[model samples]
Structures are given as C-alpha cells and as structure tokens.
Target: MILAATGMRREARIIARAGLVPVISGGDAGRLRGLLTAQAARASAIVSIGIAGALSPELRVGDIVVGDRVLIPPRNGEGDHPQGGGGERATFGGFAGPSTACGGPPPRDKLGEELLTVLPGARRGVACGSDAMVITAAAKARLYEACGGTLPLIIDMESHVAAQVAQEHGLPFAFIRVISDRADQDLPPAVTCGLKADGSMAILPVLAALLRKPAQLPALIRTARDTDRAMRSLLAACDVLARGGVGLADRG
Candidate 1:
C-alpha cells in the first residue's frame, strides 16, 4: 500500500484510493510524524501530495512541483522549531528528526520519477519544509536566498517528515505539490486562521480575522481564487494518478 501524507483533510481525501492510506498533518509536524510512524510499516512506498507555496518567483498558482529533494532549515537551538508547534530538532534516526540541512540533499528515490510519468508537465525541483507558513513575499525571498544554490522551488508543511519516514523504513518516497501562493505574494492574515487540527475549515476564526482587518478582504479574495485554481490542478493530478494506477501498481 502507499502511504500518502498531506497537510490538510481535503488533500487526503483527494488522494484516497484502493491502495493508498491518507494521513493528514493538519499543520502540526509532531502529529504528522506520529501518524507516519504508525502507518509507515504498512506502506510499500510513501508520497507527500498536496498544495504548496511557491518559493520561486517564476512559479505561479496551479504549477505542479515534483520534489527531487526535501530541505530542512538548520536548527538554531533546542527551542527553535518549524513555524508551527512541533519540535523537529535536527537529528538522525526515524521520523522524529530529519537528516538533511538547508542546502543538503537526501538520497534520491524512484517514486518522484514514477509520479512524473503520470503527472504530465510537472516541474521537478527541490522542496523546502517549514513548520509555519511562508506568508509574505519578503519572507519567501529571504528563504529563497538562504538556500543558496540549492534553490528549493516550493515550500510546504509535510514533505520533510514524510521523506524521513520513508527513509527510515527504506521505502521509496515522492513529493508532488501544486502551488497555491506565489513567491511575490503575501498571504492574508485570515489565511492562517482558517484551518483546524482535523484539517477542516473553521469559518468563525477566519471571519473574526477579517473583522479585525477589513482591508485585507481583497487580498483574501485573491488568495481564495488562487487556492481554487490550485485545487483544480490537484484534483486533475489525482485523477491521472488514479487512472494510471501509479501508486497502486507497486505493492513492494
């Protein structure tokens, strides 16, 4: 079976198939690690599939990125964690800690190559993993520069953890992400308030954020439109996977 790890419930639902088991991180790194640990043994291969933020200025919404490698930022200290409330300290062994530093590349796996066969026009690039969302254009630019020559083209919440788990178990791993926000854009504050731990949307918190900053409505609308486009692309990609039987074909 394939272990499909994603950040939201919507993404999990989209990738659900006869041979795939979907696990949602819901923006929490610790939870993602735990879920992957529990499911990794049952999976022949692992895949991280969902929408992601673009880290390259040239990428626009709905562009598909197949990660050739996943990069984790170097640890500052014990307290320094990914944007969310997870203690992803840099260490070795298992999914508890990832092995790669910001510019370091992990071992290449065949899962990404297989995904490209089913996902036509998908760009293969490096993916940077973050605990928190990269919300502003300036922050995205800084991260892009910080990686130096590695040049991660996309950023997301779950790929690093998924990669670690796959490595720990000696399983092939893949990362397929659709861009929802571009590097030049700043995500509206309301975008951060809309998700719940179970990966469901929380309308009240988003409404409260909008009430506090009414002027952000236009940006929020644009974000919504971009997300819609990304979702459509993700759905199409999932359809191709299902039809092509990429993940289902291999039971190793």
Candidate 2:
C-alpha cells in the first residue's frame, strides 16, 4: 500500500480520491509521527502530498514543487540521532550521512521526475522541512537567506519527517507539494488559527477569525482557490503512480 502524509484534511480527501491512504497531521509533528509509526508496515512508500509555502519568488501559487530531496533542519543534539551540525539529508532513494551542506547537488529521483512529467508546469527542487509552518513573508526571506540564497523550492511542516520515517524503515519516499502561498505573501493569521489540536480544521475558529479581520477575506479566498488547483494536480499525479504501478526497490 502507498501511504501519503498530508497536512490538511482537504489534502487527505484528495489523496483518498486517488485511492491512496492519507494520514492527516494538520502540521502537527507529534501526531504525524504517531500516525506514520502506526501504519509503517503496510506502506510500500511514503508520499508527502499537500500545499507548501513558496521559498522562491519564481514559484507562484498553484505551481507544483516536486522534491528530489528533503532538507531537514538540524535538531541540536536531540533524540536518538544527535546532530553533529547542520541539516540531515534524506532523498527519495535513501538517506545520506549527516552534513552541513545546504544544496550540494540536485539528487535524481526518477519517481519525482515521472510525477513531474504527468504534471505540466511542475518543477523539481530541494524541499526544506520545518517543525512548524513557515509563516509570514519576513520569515520566508530569513529562511532563504539562511540557506545562503540557494532558494529551496518550497517549505512545509511534514515532508522531512515522513522522509525520515521512510529512511528508518528502509522504504522509498517522494514529495509532491503544491504552492499555496507566494514567497512575498504574508499569510493572514487566521489561516493557521483555524487548525485544531489534531490538525483538523475547526470551522467556528476559522469563521471567528475571519469575522475579526474581514480585510483578509480576499487573500484567504485566493489561497483557497490555489489550494484547490494544487489538490487537483495531486490527484492526477496519484492516478499516474497507481496506473504505472510505481514501486521503489529495497534499499541495502
């Protein structure tokens, strides 16, 4: 079975329509870990599917960013894997030894490339995963600067974790992220305030937030539209994977 990790219920629904099992996390790292751990056995691969925040100006909303590699920021001597320094690198095929490198070379993921072929206008690049959402235009700028202007294609809260899990289990992994917000766009606070503890959306909180800040309605609507387009693209890619019977060979 192909397991998909999505950050929103909308994305999960889209994955379901493609006949893939999706685990929703609402951007909660702990919950995502639990879900992934609980269902890791039957999973032949893990697909990080959903919306992402653009880290490059060239990527506009609705553009799909397929990850050839996932850049996970270093955790300072935390957990089982102590950080020597810098981010840990995880690719579609397997995990590489820890290094401080930002964007050394673009790793080739045939699966990522194939997904791009099925998805026109989709670009392949490195994706950075964070413990939390990359909120605000200023924060996005800082992250780009921190990457030494390498300009990662996109930013999301869950991709790296899923990749890490796949690595631990020696399973293949890939990411199909769609741009939901532009690099220069400052996301309205309400966009995140609506999230529930389990990562699901609470309609009342979202409505309340919108009620307080009516000015943000237009931006919210635009984001919704872009996300819808992204989801459709994800569905199409899922179909391709399903029809193609794509599967990665076991890693040694």
Candidate 3:
C-alpha cells in the first residue's frame, strides 16, 4: 500500500481525490515511529506528500519535488524521561536543517528502484524536515550550505519520518512535495496567524485580519493560483506513474 502524508487540511483536501485517506499522524517522528513500528512490515511502500517552501530561487512556487533522501534534526536529550519537556505540540510544518543540532541521524535514502521509474524530473535533493519551517535568508542559506550547496528542490515536515520508518522496516519509500512558496516568499503572516491549532484555515478571520494590509492580497492570490497548478501537476504525475506502470524518474 502507498502511504501519503499531507501536512495541513488544505493540502490534505487536495489529495482526497486520490481516494486514499492519508493516515493523520501529526508529523512527529515519535508518533510516526509508533504508528509505523507496528505496521511497517506490512506496508509495501511509503510516501510523504505535502506542501513545502522552496529554499532556492531555481524552484518556483507550484513546482514539485520528488526526494530520494530525507533529513531531520534529532530531538533534544530527554535525560531518560522518555517524554515531556514542553516541546511544540505534534504538528507538521517544514524542514529543520542538519541533524546534529537537533537529535536525528543523517537522512536515509530509501527510494526503491520501482518508484524512481515514476519520477521523471525529480532532482536529487536531501529534504530536511523540522518542527519549524525554515524561512528567511539566513535559515535557508544554512540548510543550503549543509546540503553542500546543492539547492533543495523541496522542503517539508513529514518526509523525514517516512524515510526513517521505511529504513527501519526495509521498505521502499519516496517523497513528493509541491512547492507552495518560493525562496523570496513567506507565507502571508496573516494566513498563518488565523490558523487554529488543528490546521484548519480560519478563512473569515484570516481575511478580516488581512483587510488592513491590502498590499498582501495580490501576492496571496498569486500563491493560490500557483498552488492550484502544482496540485494538478502532482495528480498528473501520479496518474502517469501509478496507472501506466511506468517509472518516470527512470529516465533521469
């Protein structure tokens, strides 16, 4: 079976058409580990799908990224507590750069030979996942450098967990992330500010909040348009590979 992860409800809403109800694991490595620990052996393939911010200008909003490696920072020392210490609630967001600073090991490559045949234009990239999404020039630069200057075609929160789980179970895994924002862009603060803890977009509240900043409306519209395009592209890619039994990436 294919396992897909979509970070937020909006992103998840898009994949509903795939007729695959994504398992809502909240994107925490610990939580994901537990879920997969039991079922890992049964899963045929794992996929992490979601929206990510672009760390390089070469990638535009709405472009797609299919990853071969996933990087996640390790958790802080627990001191034998096993849990607790007031960490952020289990929520999915974006990539955290480097494993040493946090607590995770280096990314594991688990993309099997079969899936690669489906991803044609996927660039070889090390996708880093973090509790927090990387934004701003400094953070992006740090992650970019950590990857040895190879521009990240995509970044997301759940790919690392999928990769780790696949590794533990010796399963084939691949990550497909659609770019919702570019390197020069940040999610309109207003949109995120109105979001509740449960990942639902507070549309009216967000709009009310943004009413004062008419300047952002244009960009928001543009992002919406781009995101729509990306979604269509993703489904097209999936259909071409999943139904036709062809691996697009094999051409690479």
Candidate 3 Cα deviation (angstroms), residue 106 = 13
* Backbone collision tally, model 1: 1
Off by over 4 Å in 1: 17-19, 75-108, 149-152, 245-247
TM-score of each: 0.86, 0.79, 0.68
Off by over 4 Å in 3: 13-21, 25-41, 73-113, 193-200, 208-215, 244-252
TM-score of 2: 0.79
lDDT measured at residue 120 in model 2 versus the true structure, 0 to 100: 61
Per-candidate Cα lDDT values, in order, are: 0.75, 0.68, 0.56
By lDDT, rank the candidates, best first.
Answer: 1, 2, 3
Better of 1 and 2 by TM-score: 1
Query: lDDT for model 2, on a 0 to 1 scale?
Result: 0.68
Candidate that scores best on TM-score: 1
* lDDT per residue (tens digit) for residues 34-95 in model 2: 89988988787777888888888888877777764676544422221212243543333223
List clash counts for every candidate, in order: 1, 0, 13
- What global local distance difference test value does model 1 have? 0.75
**Candidate 1 global TM-score:** 0.86
Q: What is the lDDT of residue 166 in candidate 3?
A: 61
For candidate 3, write residues 1-252 as lDDT tens digits: 555665566656655544434544443445655665666665666677767767766887666677556554333222211121232312111233432223343344435334455666655455656555454444555554444446464556667667666655655666777777776665554544444444566678768767978787876777678777777766665665545454323321
Q: Write the per-residue lDDT of candidate 1 for residues 9-76, one digit (tens) a residue.
A: 77878878434678898888889999999988877877888999987888989999985466665532
Model 3, position 249: C-alpha lDDT score: 34
Error of 2 at 184 (Å): 0.9
